[model samples]
Target: MHRPAVIALHYQNDILHPDGLIRVGLSEDDQKRTQLLVAAKKMLDGARAHGWPIIHVRVAYRHDYADLIQNAPILKSVANIGAVKEGSWGSDFYQALAPREDCFNEHVVTHKRINPFYDTQLCVLLRGLNIERVLIAGVATHSVVESTARHAVDCGFHVTVAADACASASSESHNHSLNSMRLIAEVSDVQSTLEALK
Candidate 1:
């Protein structure tokens, strides 16, 4: 059986759909569709009930755009077009899927890159816990989730993507991304994955 901590990737509150413009903030419907807040909740709930650890990998800068400007020029340029900024609602996790103080066992990384493992302490933390399998969930199915999944596999971690627990700007992109992930990792919905874990 797989013993793993659920690694919920960055659920940042920026608009990452349509034209990749931050000005296109998530509306009520977009939040429901893109963030998949309820799906994430179910996954977390299952993990909590099973007494499994939860690692939240949030993306936030240190109140400055310098890191992104220096390390990720692509992100910096997008910010120039009104993308999310540090310490803003657009930069924080979505309200529904906010990190829980009591249940949040690890904040493995505060990332600038799309992949949470890149230049972050994620691998160190996991290795310290002797964790080898990672159950991935959270926002922007194509970007953050897929990016981290790819890197996690590269780092020799067994990765499982919670399909319904993730979302992207579009269904087409989300489906394609999930399909690609299935080729490289375990891809399933919350129920199927939780059942397998147990």
Candidate 2:
């Protein structure tokens, strides 16, 4: 069996917290659904129990925003709102989903772009840990989650996305992205994922 790892993406204050910088743009229902902290915690615990590495990924930019890419609408929104600056609380991992200090080989990977693999040490870390399959869970299903899933598939890792642990700005976008990811990755829920890890 391929060694598995859980890649929790973009579980940052700017995206998951109610008092987050971008929370105003999310619908009430979306905000409720975006509360993946509990589900992510469960997944992380399960992964640890199974001896799988847990990789927490977040997006953060320089305080000066010099490294940020504002070419796209989403990027522009992030820049305009001053979200996820390197030294700011908005860039910190969500409190409930933060990585545990006791877990061996657990990693906190930071990326400058939407895809966690882009110009990041994520691939290297996975390779060092001999990770061949990835279980992904995070916010904005249509963006970071989907982007990372597709990239993982392209990089030759078997990918599974925890459907219930991911949320978007709207239900429509979330479902749509999940359907799209289904074509390339296994789409599952947190319980099913935990069972598989065992």
For residues 129-148, write the lDDT of model 2, one tens digit per residue. 88889999888899999999
The per-residue C-alpha lDDT of model 1 at residue 94 equals 62
Identify the leading candidate in terms of lDDT: 2
What lDDT would each prediction earn against the true structure? Answer: 0.74, 0.85
Candidate 2: worst-modelled 10 consecutive residues by lDDT: 24-33
The superposed Cα distance between candidate 2 and the true structure at residue 69, in angstroms, equals 1.9
Q: Tell me how candidate 1 scores on lDDT.
A: 0.74
- Model 2 scores a TM of 0.93
Q: Candidate 2: deviation at residue 44, Å?
A: 1.0
Native-to-model Cα distance after best TM-score fit, residue 66 in candidate 1, in Å: 1.1
Global CA lDDT of candidate 2, please? 0.85
User: Compared with the true structure, what per-residue lDDT tens digits does model 1 show for residues 75-176?
Assistant: 765556655567766666666666777764645468778787888888888887788888998767888889989988998999999998887656788899
Model 2 residue runs over 4 Å out of place are 24-31
Give the Cα error of residue 129 in candidate 1, in Å: 1.5
